[model samples]
Target: MEPENTTQNKPRGRVVMLVDNGVKGDSRVQKAARSAADAGWDVVLFGVSPDGEKHSWKVGSAEVRLIPKPGPLNPRRHDMRRPLFRRPLAYRSPQVARYRVQAVKAWRSDLSFRQAAVKAARAGHPGRSAGGSKARLLVPRVSSKVYSKWVALRARETTDLQQRRSMLDARLDRATTALWQGLMKQRSWRRLTPNLWDFELAFAKHIDKLKPDLIHAHDFKMLGVGARAAVRARAAGRPVKLVWDAHEYVPGLPPRHGRWLPGHVAWEKEHAVFADAVITVSPALAELLKKGHGLSQLPTVVLNAPVLSPGPDEVAGAGPVPDLRELCGVGPNTPLLAYVGGINPVRGVETIVEGLTQLPDVHVAMVSVPPGKPYAATATIRKLVDKLGVGDRVHFLPFVPHWQVAEFVAPADAAVSPLHHLANHELALSNKFFEYSQARLPQIVSDIRTMSEMVRSTGQGEVFRAQDTDDYVRAVKAVLADPERYRAAYDKPGLLEKWTWEAQAEILDGIYSRLLPDRPRIAAQPSGSRADARA
Candidate 1:
């Protein structure tokens, strides 16, 4: 660790922020890093590198470091105690015992042999020589009756044994599952997810070397990373404060197969209590986090609003924002609807494409994530578009800078947010909701609790049944018919201004100030001092 400057002018404490993404398009983390750096703290943001090599760049005053995230990538490999095939009883499927198989086969073989012997005896019988045909027939019939009774008795015994084995397997399975779940309650049980451990292995040493005064963990995965790092730093006699930024309500996220959902929920529950402070994107989320973590104070709310403009605190490098109508090859007279953010089924983007079939001359501009790369959801949406024969009307564009989203979509006739009625969607406002309002584009939002209520209350636009194509078409036409009336919602006092990143940054800065009052301010340093600075 760098020795503290002992001079009369002490350097401000350093802050390290951890995120699980590549950090190229994560507006919330970028905004937080820039805001903290502007407030005079030496901030370094760490993210997972897409490539194997480590890379670094400057996001305004904050230094962004992308650490290589090497992995086996499978959760099952993390458990040192068991091999892949030898999973715990609860995770393994029941197999028929070898003894039972052998026993059943032996009984069937004996019965076949007895039946053949009886037929041979009937064929060789004294047939009409002594007591004639009656004797031969009687002998075969008596043997057949005896053999049938024996087969019935053995079958009943085999059936009873099989039933007992099934009952035992069931009881054992239940017991093992209960035991595994009980073990998961302990913090050490996190080893089940090796990828998470890989994250810690990749970033912990770098974080420790920096000896940061504060660790701001973004989302659930980093919360554990930051919390554990803080514990290590404290043990080494360095005082490190921890801040957990809950990006979403983990329990409310869509269900995932295997251990993903429960593992993350457990991980969050374990580490959230260690945070000196917590911040989330919405008031509803904040309240849930407060109660869920049993924190004494409610988490500070920082909505993921768009940048009003490039201020001293905001980061640059998003490149030029494109104009929506020009990008769509549409004129002002043509009706255009815009959708931004990730492409997913739950996002309800299919509703928009399906709606286009009914509303001719209406074009859609969909801006998806990771810029140019094709993702699974993107492919699905494309297939739907092709199937519906609306390929010509829908224009798929790469995402613009987060701050520039509103400007990018400003020329569209109206913005549509057709998010499905998921729990997280219902409980919070989406980034597009605020972005559309900032552009003064009339909104066509789904009837999710938070967004629908906001749109209805503000009179910004109309709400439709989530994922209902017919209703979505109705809302889109309503807006297209009289966009002026819906656009008037922006005229309401402080509506747009209240939802900008600048407003949210103030609350963020205040939280920082309150948490680290004693920490001194670090003087601004040059960017090229780092060894890994991008060429």
Candidate 2:
């Protein structure tokens, strides 16, 4: 239930939400902004522009602005490129020095071999010995013995030099790797990947101008941005509240680069303290984040559940929700499985495609890749399907609007969440899990802890070993054999109601209300102040 807002009649406050994505498919941020707006707060959601250009739009009463954050300061590509904020060339370019040393050693090795050959040749020559014919002949025999020894010694020395050269190369490579890892372990690792700086530079000025009473930073990248902006507001005597919404555990995420894990962990550690309140996706994640950050208060768990609609057969939105079965060109009786979410290796999309080969009659609607966009995983999935010779059985489709996902995927016989067992995957019930439940589709989920336990406890569907093709086939066969039995799980009263964005939004509203009670607020920028002058 939504906490009673004692400040309901008071003037609504302005909120500036900062996220790190393009905001096109980010449902969590979209839902949060929309919920805040619906609760009578003026909301502006700022996100990084996908095409390095500005974009503006509206999500319900909330305003969305995509700021173009273009520069060499991307964490994914930071270490690969020349450092954006460079150190001294000698300090930065160790590869250059390593290569130079290897080249000189190679040159010296070659020169020694050549000089030894010349000396051996000279020693063997008869004319170089000062003596009579007998002595000359004897000298030739002795010189030949000496020259042979020299040749043997030189060959061994050359082999040793080459081996030493290889060892030196390997040593240097290890040294380089160690140096990088060491630097990332330090307190100032953020300087190496200055992408956060780029984000701050892009959004901070806009944040100041908005004069927001609250700053909602989505994920780790924006945590610092929101904190700095909140400090700026407070320093100017505006008293803005900061909320950090940690989407996932930083250490649990797949590291994009060598410095990605440690750098982000340190970054979040520094800025998370500034947040007046924290919001997270699941109870498990909330507990982990609380312990990880050692926060004064545990984070509020706001699930990424779909917004509940009035009718099951129809969506509340205006757009046409595509039929998953029709798109696959399969009839209602056909065994159809729907997989909704982004296409990635860890998502275990390959397990679903591979499993299709065993269930020949089964057709799958892969809503993996986004519409009209090039995703690398699309090709990977296609290659796997082609290799397995299941092209005709699979259908590739685009994503529907966030609110329509449950309705969009409802036509399929069952929904599959074959997510691989990663730390985050094991802990949380994915949005698709709730969406499938909302659609009343029997779930064929992976054996990852949370979703699997839910599936077993609720008797919603079958749980298979994650990434195990044979186990997935068995689970699919079980569900297709008696999907209605699994579907009956939805018949339980109020189960669907508990897993919804509306229910999650109530928790969000309460968090906002508790953080910023009934009070008068100052402008984010005061008149004749430096912030106003900059604006």
Best TM-score goes to which candidate?
1
For candidate 1, the lDDT comes to 0.75
Q: Distance from true position, residue 368, model 2, in Å? A: 2.4
Error of 1 at 501 (Å): 1.3
Stretches of candidate 2 exceeding 4 Å from the true structure: 1-10, 72-186, 309-319, 519-535
For candidate 1, which ten residues in a row score worst on lDDT?
A: 87-96
Where does candidate 1 stray beyond 4 Å?
A: 1-11, 72-177, 183-188, 311-320, 520-535
Clashes of 2: 0
lDDT of 2 by residue, 95-179 (tens): 4344544555564454445445555557785332233343434554555556545544544444443344333234543464456
Error of 1 at 432 (Å): 1.8
